[model samples]
Target: MKIEIGKDFPKFFKPLYQEEFELFSHFETTAGIPTVLFAITTWKENGKPNVCFHSWSCFHGDKTAFFAVMGNLYQHTHTYTNIQREKCFCINFLPISYYDKLIDTIHQNDLETDEFEVGNFTLSQANVIHAPIIQEAFINMECTLKEVQDLSGAGITAMIIGKVEHISVDEKYAQGYERYGKDGFMMLIPAPQNILTGEPNQSAIASVNIEKYD
Candidate 1:
């Protein structure tokens, strides 16, 4: 199916900004970019674990990375405080299938309760970090906060980028016994008449194995 070009995202090709230029190459990362869902639950005065998660783009094709904070620090946010105190967080690249559940979690829920428990998602300890990982997430990117730079320019969110250390995936997405990209891996195929036609353009999100293109 030909993706008819309707009204283009007017902002896609606008004038260049310093912030846009810095992160221009993020689209070409070699890692499986799971729109990260950050869960905060420590509840520290400085490190209060707040159960707040959002969709953040993966950076540098690295599994372990920091939350997407590409502007200024906010005045009151459970996410910010959690990042400030904990210094380490887990990046669960949730599939688009869990969109509704994630959206509900992002929306203001209970102040003292965790969405993980409320949402009925399996709660597991991070392999190398101190954050919670949604067991249902196909590929989990465990990130350790390395640096918090203040990119307070015109109107940008402070960038909270970090480095990756360890990563884990579901057995279904794993190849053989130790490698990623198994038969059950989900994939998201772009709409193309050369491939998909009248049939449902169904694709698997977790099936995108990084080893295939290599």
Candidate 2:
């Protein structure tokens, strides 16, 4: 038989942290979806380089244009405000090895903090945008803000879309299939809750493991 999860919050679903439930819906843990992790670089109003280690986003486009649809960006984050004021940002895709460095940026991030320094990253200007990029990233996509929407209308998080203007790929990883293994991309595995017992599990950082070609 199949179990049914209805619109009402599941009584059997418990969050690992109360604050997490407040910031993110319980469904997040319930679904435990995984997404690509990347660093969003911008200039804080104070002129310090800001790096937001983030996920919950997708990228796609057609012949006309491409877009970066970033979701669950907190309205209060400097990254959000910076994008609004600067009208641009850069997305840097680093490997799983830099996960710890990225986490350091999260802990040390303040209005005046130079996040690049916190992560011991080499900063460089984007070729097309007025934002900063991480030189270590295998791929860097420069984007201009296209739109922002309060998808839930709850005044908490937002879905910010950016038009991809240009992409810079590291010459070493330019070869096809090179950007798919352990040194390629990082992923975020959401904390999963035990559906039957309501016990919460820890979130994890992961790398892609290719098993097949299709």
Candidate 3:
């Protein structure tokens, strides 16, 4: 049997009317949301350091980037408050070797806990900013806050835009950059998945070669 809906058929017609979909649930069905995991470091007004794992981030322009932080949804969160006061941060791009540490840091909720000490990571001073960069990371970007935009009407989430002032790469990775033939010398990019249960799928690391087009 063959059935075809012609042009006369209504575009809104559905076989099941009760099967309504919800917003933000498309993460389960879609793929290819590149997750570049990094540690956002900031300093408090009292000279204390704070760090947190941020997977949702992207480049906005040649020298600008943005990351979404849900600090407005909760009180006493150090990442938002610290950035608000300091107006600068360092994004340290983590490699696969730091996967365990990243997971451990994500589970930590104490605002007073220093992630560098807890994750067994070292901090290196940024050249252009006061924020400390993760010494173990392969790449670091020192950025100054440029703008803040409300992502949601209820103020659940806000986007933090920053202008990258300086960038640093490890020496080994720097050599690998020219050769493009180093083993395990790539950044870790996880696949998007359910945020609550941390289940239903496995994450992946993405690495690709650049192909120039004419």
How do the predictions measure up, each by TM-score?
0.55, 0.97, 0.68
Regions more than 4 Å wrong, model 2: none
lDDT tens digits, residues 1-214, model 1?
5533233322233323344324433221222244333343334343323455443444575344434332233425666667677786666655445556655766645557566766567877878878777788766766677767655453334466656667788776566432333333223332221211222222124434454452
User: What lDDT tens digits, residue by residue, belong to model 3 across residues 111-150?
Assistant: 6666677788896788988897889877788889887767
Q: After superposition, how far is residue 64 of candidate 2 from its true place, in Å?
A: 0.7
Model 2's C-alpha root-mean-square deviation from the true structure amounts to 1.0
Order the candidate numbers by TM-score, best to worst. 2, 3, 1
Q: Give candidate 1 misplaced runs (Cα > 4 Å).
A: 1-51, 61-75, 153-156, 176-214
| Each prediction's whole-model lDDT (CA) | 0.50, 0.92, 0.61
Residues 102-160, candidate 2: write the lDDT tens digits: 99999999897999999999999999999999999999999999999999999999999
lDDT of 3 at 134: 87
**Candidate with the larger lDDT of 1 and 2:** 2
**lDDT for position 70 in model 3:** 24
Which candidate, 1 or 3, has the higher TM-score? 3
Number of clashes in model 1?
25
